[model samples]
Target: MIDALYVAETGLQAGQKHIDTISNNMANLNTTAYKKGRIEFRDLVVGREVTSLDETGKRDLVSIGNGTQISRVWKEFQSGDLKATENPLDLAIRGGGFFEVLLENGEVAYTRNGAMKVDEDGYLGTLTGYRFSDMIQIPPDAKELEISQDGTVTAYFDNDSLEIGQIQLAGFMNAQGLDSIGQGIYVANDESGNAIYSDAGENGIGILQQGYLESSNVDLVKELVELVTAQRGYQACSHVIRAADEIMQITNDLRG
Candidate 1:
């Protein structure tokens, strides 16, 4: 009964984590370029002491799986739906690549959010104000801005156009290993490897689509179904714990 109680407690914990991940995904369904999170679980095993002696007086070690635990929470890198905003500054990636941005602390971060804004200094940046690290600046008095599929930036003024700067996309050996730093920014970790710079449409990188933005990849129906499963699993674990407690109570009553 004690072991059952402990196992049920672990189950409850795992179920709670699962539900939390699902809730986060659902909440970010409308977030621009938002990637969904997933929780992985592993079984916890308990083993007998190696020095323990069996009935035959010989040392024996036995292993038994006790319960489950959350192994990891990973992000899904699948592309989201591309939405047409008709805004000239809006951009969408048609393949795999992340936009490079410079953080306040001068650290580099990556994102898939392409909703951009031009600052007073003619600096191009994300809607949240993270400027492009590559110094892609727009010129003042430019009547129009154009971003080519290859990420070349062109400014048009008085029926004349000039190439200013180019936006470079960064690719990773393992994009899933990137750490989410909130606000659609991700920093590369050891597991994610180093960021590989490439032209937007070159070297397996994705092309940029002007006047579009990428939508969150979260699937509402799938998340709702998973939410139901997590809730049921939690309830079942609770029932197990209650049953174990009742068994102990019954034993005490019988002794009395």
Candidate 2:
């Protein structure tokens, strides 16, 4: 009876975790450059619940069934579609990759937000005004600017001439192992492996676009379906608990 209770409780806890994941995905439905998370679970016998004291690994034979456990929850970095807003500074990646932004903490943060802008000092920056790895200085006196899909930055001055620079993108050997630092920023980890530096549209890093933003990939309908499924599963586990309690009550009555 106790073991049955434990099984029901474990199942309920795991289902709650599943519900939590769904909730978070729904909450980030409008977050820019947002990625979805997935939950993984497993089961195995944790210990000897049967009372056969083998105190030694040498004596009684005890068989135990598998119990529940959550293995790992990981993030999916699949690219969302690029939305054209016609904003001069908005940018997006047409394929696989992330934008490199320098953080104030002397760390580099990666994102998918391509909405960029130039500040008063002619420094190239994200929509939030965080400068890219290298500050791209345009002459305040420049007449026009053009950024190529290949991440080449060119500025046309009053002399009808253009100067060029390269925007850098960071690639991790194991991007799945990277950590989300919130606000669409991702920080690398040792498990994420070292960043493999590369140019846009090279080595599978993806091309850049100007005047566009990536849309959130979350589909509310799909998530709602999943949420309904999780709720049903939790209810099923609760049913198990209720059934077990009824059986326990009957046993007590018989004892009387």
The most accurate candidate by TM-score is: 1
TM-score of each: 0.95, 0.86
The per-prediction tally of clashing pairs is 0, 3
Q: Give a tens-digit lDDT track for model 2, residues 77-100.
A: 888777888876677888877777
Off by over 4 Å in 2: 47-63, 119-121
lDDT for each residue of candidate 1 in 1-256, tens digit (9 for 90 to 100): 9999999999999999999999999999999999999999999998776777889998887788798999989999999989999999999999999999999999999999999999778799998889999787787789999999999999999979999999999999999999998998999999999999999889989999999999999999999999999999999999999999999999999999
CA RMSD for every model?
1.9, 3.0
Error of 1 at 84 (Å): 0.6
- Candidate 1 positional error at 157, Å: 0.4
lDDT of the structure predicted as candidate 1: 0.94
Residue pairs clashing, model 2: 90-211, 90-212, 91-114
